[model samples]
Target: EPEVTQTPSHQVTQMGQEVILRCVPISNHLYFYWYRQILGQKVEFLVSFYNNEISEKSEIFDDQFSVERPDGSNFTLKIRSTKLEDSAMYFCASSGGLVVFQETQYFGPGTRLLVL
Candidate 1:
């Protein structure tokens, strides 16, 4: 399986600032997702996109968060405003398909964001 890859392995930003995280999902993937894991928390889903639109999103993905597919192979996650609690490792993932109810997703190395 092709792996998802994220850019800017680490980032430090001030509270209230905006950050755009870049990702390249698997070439043939039909599903994309963004997830975050705070310092000591379990991974939490932020949003899922399919067919050029968001299919599902968690409460954590409020107005402050947005996702976009700018081209055939790139997907991005933008944080409109950063907060202290937003510090975490953001991971981009891609799954082959959704036909079987569940698909194995591969995650990127993750982009670590630190809000100060």
Candidate 2:
């Protein structure tokens, strides 16, 4: 089965630096999302994009964050200004439709971001 894949399994950045994480979502999937887990915290949604625009976004997706489908097969999340609190495991997921019913999201292992 085709699965989502993230690059640079781990990343370390200085506080206030910019960071961009990359992912390749499952082929044939129509929706994409970004979620983060701060150590022991629960997974939180950051944003969701479909049809070339943002569909839903959480408060956590503040001014410092942005996302793009830079190419046909690549999706990326960029943090313009990283913070120490930004250190976490960022997971990329894709779903075919809204999850209110049977839509299931497939997740990549994750890209661990560490800010110092």
Best by lDDT: 1
Each candidate's clash count: 0, 0
Q: Which 10 consecutive residues of model 2 have the lowest summed lDDT?
A: 94-103
TM-score of 1: 0.96
lDDT of model 1 at position 114: 98
**All candidates: CA RMSD (Å):** 1.1, 1.5
Candidate 2 lDDT over residue span 1-116, tens digit each: 88999987999999999999999999888899999999999999999989899989999999999999988888899999999999999999998755524789999999999999
C-alpha TM-score for every candidate: 0.96, 0.95
Clashing pairs in 2: none
Full-model lDDT, candidate 2: 0.94
- lDDT, candidate 1, 1-116, per-residue tens: 46789998999999999999999999999999999999889999999999999999999999999999999999999999999999999999998865825788899999999999
Which residue window of length 10 is worst by lDDT in model 1? 96-105
Query: Which candidate has the top score in TM-score?
Result: 1
Give the clashing pairs for model 1: none
